[model samples]
Target chain A: MMAKSQTHSDGDLGDLLRVRDGFVLADVDTRSTPGYGQTKSDAQDDLAAGAEEFDELQERLYAQSRENPDSPAVLLVLQAMDTAGKGGIVRHVIGATDPQGIHLKAFKKPTPEELEHDFLWRIEREVPRAGYIGVFDRSHYEDVLIGRVRSLATPDEIERRYDAINDFERRITDAGVHLVKVMLHISKDEQRERLAERLERPDKHWKFNPGDIDERQLWDDYMGAYQVVLDRTSTPHAPWHVVPADRKWYARLAVQALLLDVLERIDPQWPVASFDVEAEKERLAAS
Target chain B: MMAKSQTHSDGDLGDLLRVRDGFVLADVDTRSTPGYGQTKSDAQDDLAAGAEEFDELQERLYAQSRENPDSPAVLLVLQAMDTAGKGGIVRHVIGATDPQGIHLKAFKKPTPEELEHDFLWRIEREVPRAGYIGVFDRSHYEDVLIGRVRSLATPDEIERRYDAINDFERRITDAGVHLVKVMLHISKDEQRERLAERLERPDKHWKFNPGDIDERQLWDDYMGAYQVVLDRTSTPHAPWHVVPADRKWYARLAVQALLLDVLERIDPQWPVASFDVEAEKERLAAS
Candidate 1:
């Protein structure tokens, strides 16, 4: 069930920002508003409105899952440059819903046991169970992104992963997972400013990693790798959306709209009672 | 570091609601707000105010955990009869914080694999890693409560569980986990209204179960089992609090206050940066 409704005046932000055929990473302006004509205040207002809608839709999805064991689950895969507001999207966008309904996993550097297995092995274990909004902070895409840039994996192995990820996405989405893969696109100039800001604040230091600068030095190489990712894995069932990261508020608002699109399409209805309500009420009264 | 500042004009709700010495299960009036002197509007205003404070305190705890591997974690254990608003507490209270900082687990009937091991095995697996606020909707206390009331386990098995729970709690708290054990105390009359209301609404049907009626039939026995649990399992490390839950607002507010107290005591400070700040600034600018 593809979501057909559009609540925003600019139409579906997902469609406007999606990486399609002949997409180029460098060509897209990081600071552009793209489809949104709204001001920062408008974005904030829309985000708050979207959050309320998300909370209700999430509740419906969760309630539907209680009876239907095969009820569909949504997997939101967030891949971004450092300080592109992945954490903010989590807090400001999806954070308004019932915490019980959301399953959040931040994939860090693989543990020894995780490193021993196929990349998808660790990832598949954490897919949202039925009726959940599963979020992967830095997902399997890392195995390819960082893996490709750092030459951590053999070229042959890296080549196999692109297809493996495509195959994996196809399988899970076929098995009732609505995948919303996002790449938060920020420019090198924006990266320098963000990193500098992190360094400026003592409270923010714990979040600033020296390695992020090390990665920033290879900006061109990482951009090419991301382009390759966008080209190879942006498929029908699991297409990737390129959210401009320079505007933190816009990125979060866009992601929230994308999720709302999916849930609205699924249209999870409240489950009918499986028991005799009249008899139960009588028994409940007696008790 | 114990949080000495309380926003509530009424002294610490944690102390007022705590199941302390000479406490009697029958003595607490489920409808009464023991120390809170306010109208429902006042409770609502206070609850809205508490959510903002909880948000900031939770952020500090999460931030501390990032820099210090041995940072403290908080565990909230909720127990009570069905319809006592465990889900409500999860939604309205903890829902106000960053979902990344909260780890929520709702214990169900034991799976074959889980039943294969000790009761605490499944529990231990789900404990919040450092720098998190972990919540257990129903926990190992079930082994003793349901195990005793339904004779699911022998007297010998049930008898062993209480001591086992206390020992397990003592060990975890020593390992930098702050335990907040709460029982949402609701009267039978209040429960009947809640169940009837669920029966009255089609959207809420999925939550209503005939099994709840079966459990309701054994209310006194379950209360007896609870008394035994409070008597045996409540310890210095993991004391229990009975929040009169006839008023849903008070229960959620009280649980939030109890958590604030623990966080206040732990007082997770913003982590100190490990790197040379000025050097990093130069390095970041060059990149």
Candidate 2:
């Protein structure tokens, strides 16, 4: 069942993929590409075509923000399990655009200094400026996901983070940021194959972590934690999208489509030149 | 007038442009493109051609760092007065690379909380990770530039920051970072014209702060402050390159060339695969 009425040709992916109230992660098919009907080659073609449009739209957003400092920005938060293709999405989807227009931060293990501040302190510092597309690869959800399954934080502290994250999302959205939170979903079998391949490949050996396998063993617990996250933190302002990532091509295309949808809705335009164009051109030429 | 022996055809721009002992800000022509024998069109062609090479080199650097976490990173510190084209350099030079590899920080007026820490505390938080190209739009030099000119810090305190900066830079470089400090030099008349253009254009109105004119009034003092900065902090390990920025195209091209030189020197290669690649490929195919 869809959360919202279908409006677009591809149907509203946000409505279809968004985790609604009383959502269950287990019920969603990790192998299915909901509302999208395209072959892998077709998806590749569509993604390639969309790159130029995405680039132009990003530039427009950057230009508009530069001219009007109060303009809004977009933030795409990507969270996924190990081997779920988050890197591919970042490289293929967001990577096609101008680096000048993007603000990306990959949160690793918290530094000693970071742990001293409230969990949100470091996250707040990396929020994109006006007219930019800020991407967070594995965001604040880590505090809840790993913290919940690993019992890193006390139960009471873990409960507080959910509330803190919700409030933080609301505050950022109110301050003119369109937040797009994505969870790239892949099956256990798929992850196993991916990890196995990493072990077999010398080039991918560096990417393979023994810790990832440890977390994989606690998969069900992590899933339960994610269920709670979907229930608690998926607010209207910054709802989470459960993107089936078994097909990397489909997932990258879908993410790009989602970004395009948001940018279309925002409809950022290049600011009209405020100076006399002809006069300025003449002056520049003379100079 | 060479500070170091020439090693390449480009004649080691790092050596030529570097602020050596007894460096005079006034002696360096703001309009000159020293050691670069190219017209504006020729520079543009070179920049376009080098973009792909720069992107590839950056990716290799990123890959190398990802594989070997201890690998060094490059930090490019850009300092310039209002309308001196720091934004242009960022857009043209660094913008051509992967956003994922870039760590860009535009230091605004520090927050009340930031001021509570040692000034370098905020700077340290924003330092680029291993394999990243960290670009600071305005950096630690601000403390000396504004602090000395406006007397924000006591004479003794201002003197202390110089030593502190040198020590801090040495520590970072020792910890595997190649620091490249750049100051975009523009003449008083050039700045006045640029300021006039900003005022003339309504789109640029947001960029033109009335306070810039106030700062312009004290140009001589700022220049004196910059002279001291060049003299006191231009260490061999973390030397400052003063780029003549009157020509925006030339400045952008020169900055890119400078970055290319640093990257060339670093010569990062893709890490050798530790695992059996053929086995991984077969496993991935089978899976």
Candidate 3:
């Protein structure tokens, strides 16, 4: 009887693994989704090629705003588990951007002052102005991830937050803020390799916390928590793109594609000059 | 008398150029100073090499902290003219540092809210916690530069700010924050070239504001302002390193060197546990 129960558990695990892998493949190919890149490839080399194209697209999007003073603002939220490569994606995809046009805010464990306010208050303060891009590294998603994992909030309260975030994102989207959300997902085995690498590499050691292993032990809990996070918050206006983060470059490229798609959708145009430059030139010539 | 006056003016211009060139060189070299690295041939080369080395050093520093848990924090302050390479340096050098351990804050033209408080208030709020690095792009030196150049303060008032800034640096330094200040200097001709390049480059056209040229016309005044900024704020605790701006790579390398130098000074050691591993292992094995 015990052996039969063990077999049943193993079968359930295998099914989950298959489903996760399927999502990984689907994410790379689904270009029809709004704010997603159309070009899809599974090979590492193809992903890199796509990355190069995506980078050029991003530069052009930034250029669009520079040329046109009235482009709507863009806010990109990146939330993921540890070793999900948030900084790597930021540097690879967003590093070349004009610093004046991009703002990066990394939210750590909330400070005492931040805790005193609502979950979104600190994030609200860092929103990019119109015509600029704001990138959040581990943003307000923490409210759900940490709060739910620890049972810090009641079930009803958690449900309310899911709605609150949906409403919040929609309001920001309506108010000329283009919101793109990406959740970087990595397999448990991949996460183990990454954590081990951080432990072995002296330079990466500072980022390693033994506490992370404790969280790793709670892997099933986190997966369950993230499942809830994705299902509840993935709305039409600010749907979450679960990027496969095992390939760091691919994740970055995918993010860039989403950004470019949003900016291109805006179709920014240069502001009109109040006077004619040719007439002024002719006046000066006549004088 | 006219000949003597021309000679004096020429000497003044030469002194100004010498000081300006010194700043440009120091800014480039300082980036590499915090780590072991070679000086580059030109600004572009310096930035590339400096960036690579700075990234490596940041990783090393973090690794050291994780291993030892006692590494002193490194604080980098970037001060430069409007188009100086502050943003680029920031993107390249600190770009790879773990976002959790790195704090980046841009001090823009003071808002009304900022003006209500002391000049250092905003900065105080952004200082990194223990075991973290803080990078400030345009820091408190504006108190001396803008204050003196615009004559917004009386001579005594400017002098007081200098003293206050010195005190501020001393306090932070004494409290374990290693402060490295860099000033990026560009020639008037280089400024013209950069401004024109922005206008001519389709992608950079938006970065070009005609008002920037208006500020360029006050080149002499701004130089005087920087000279005062340097003289008044260059305390032994936080001496300013001026880097040449004509070569961006060289400036990046210089900055990297300054960072490595400070990190090497505070080589953090990982604390070892005093427990008997053999006994613990045996107990675990038996269990």
Candidate 4:
């Protein structure tokens, strides 16, 4: 699996980590940081350095959008099992910049208002503005994730959701919103240890829930649901990156690097000011 | 001014930088990095290190909100003249984190759709979701800034907007959006130099505008407009921080520090998971 990931360049971490056709989610190591050949501390330092540049590129995207409304925005959808560190990614990766440029939504149990509409209704409302970054902690995939695992939705409905999500993402990308879907993968043992730690810590008690055990009973079923999700919904326009998330620092760094790669590809520039500079300078000097 | 800023503890940069009653925007030097007695390089390093911690706290805020919808969001409204580096601040200060948690709006010329409604209709649509950071690049304040300088709105209407803005912000704060308004102030000489630099580079020519000079001719008028804006709308819920914009690094660091201070005060904690952890752990281990 590592060898397969190594075929891609280090710079294209997205390609290296992205799930392609006939990919096996189970084969990928949850502890591996493919394409990045650095120590944990070194990766941390790189992430810190890259953050400044990321800020610049994100700003350029924002500036271009201001000058041209058709400019593109980026959306990162994080899907993971409870305790897989989706929250950590949201904080460590996306939290580095000014809160002003981000749009974050953590999908919870559908409300009465939400159930009245299609599952995608709430998601459509939260897409990032042009040049902004939109993050979904858990997303429409939930309808398929827990829905399939818990049999909350019928098979036909789950299938329809997969199609709906693909179409919805395509429409978004066509309208200049780049989508990066990430699945944070952790092993059963790692999760057990994390859960035990949560139980041991008084401060972490709020973060633990007994319901998670009910979900754990269906781990294989949940994995099957995830496999189906990765297979059906990971389209070319909105490919899914299955990040090995046992190591939180590496996961955060990889996600950051992935976003940086996307922003660099977009290459948004500072929009040319549409006003007269020479005349303005002279007039200002005179004033 | 620097001495006054230094009188406060380092953690209280927000209060140090905030505009209060009888505050004079012009009296604040545009070159000083108040409440932060570090070199530009040191500040940059400090900002880099703090970026991770900032991301964590912001995530906690978002997490808390997810667990409790009534949790507050922070809104950073940036107002500045062209070439004052609002773009830089948005990128450097706000851009460092996950774009997922940010809601950024750069208000430009109102569209036919926008013109049909109240000036704030568009603004209301863009307010940050709960637990998110909302950033306005040239926000509703522009209604008064340009509206006053260009006389786009009648003087009576301008006065009415001042009142309207106050009411609107009061409502926003009342609804749990902690607003941190900032004005990036630059001098006439600095503006000339930046404009000239913009003209000298083809890559930057796109960022140069002739209309900015027309506005430059009314720099004093704009200053008076900003002063009035600060005086009328800088309420307790949403105070204005007039940051010195001559040094881009210093301004970015100061604004970031100011936001950090606000987030610290809000101090959002990670939400406790609302499930049975022990049962879940046992079920998982057995499985």
Tens digits of per-residue lDDT for model 4, A1-287: 12222332264677788899999988989988778777788767776776777666766787787778899999999998889998878766776665556777888999999999998999999998897888899998999999988888788988899999999999999999999889999987788888788877755766666777678777888899999999998898989999998988788877887888788779898877665556655655675
Using alpha carbons, what is the TM-score of model 1?
0.97
By DockQ, the best candidate is 1
Residue B268 in candidate 1 has what lDDT? 82
Model 3 TM: 0.74
Off by over 4 Å in 4: A1-21, A32-75, A91-105, A124-134, A167-179, A202-206, A234-241, A249-287, B1-21, B33-42, B45-68, B95-103, B125-133, B174-176, B236-238, B260-287
- Candidate 4 lDDT by residue in tens digits, B1-287: 12222343364577777888999988988887777777777767776766666767776777687668888999988888899998888776777666656777878988999989988999999988789998889889888988888888888988899889989999988999988888989998898888888777756775676777778878899999999998998888778889888999778877777777778878787777666556655665686
Model 1's alpha-carbon lDDT is 0.88
The candidates, ranked best first by lDDT, are: 1, 2, 4, 3
Stretches of candidate 1 off by over 4 Å are A1-8, B1-8
Q: Give the per-residue lDDT of model 2 (tens digit) for B155-226.
A: 999999999999999999998888989999999889878977875665555455556777877889999999
- Preferred candidate (lDDT higher): 1 or 4: 1
Over A1-287, each residue of candidate 2 has an lDDT whose tens digit, in order, gives 01111322268776788888988999988889787776777667777877777887887788788768889899999998999998887877887886768888899989999999988899999999899999999988999999889888899999999999999999999999999999999998899888887776555666766667678878899899989999998998889889999999878877887788788888887676655555544443343
Q: DockQ of candidate 1?
A: 0.83
- What tens-digit string does per-residue lDDT give for candidate 3 at A180-210? 8887777766777777676555445556665
Cα miss at A20, model 4 (Å)?
Answer: 4.6
**Higher TM-score: candidate 2 or 3?**
2
Between 1 and 3, whose DockQ is larger?
1
lDDT of 2: 0.82
DockQ, all models: 0.83, 0.17, 0.14, 0.36
Error of 2 at B27 (Å): 4.5
Task: Please list, in the order the candidates appear, how each scores on TM-score for chain B only.
Answer: 0.96, 0.95, 0.76, 0.93
Model 1 C-alpha lDDT per residue in residues B28-102, reported as the tens digit of each score: 899888667777887887888878888988998988988888999999999999999999999999999898899
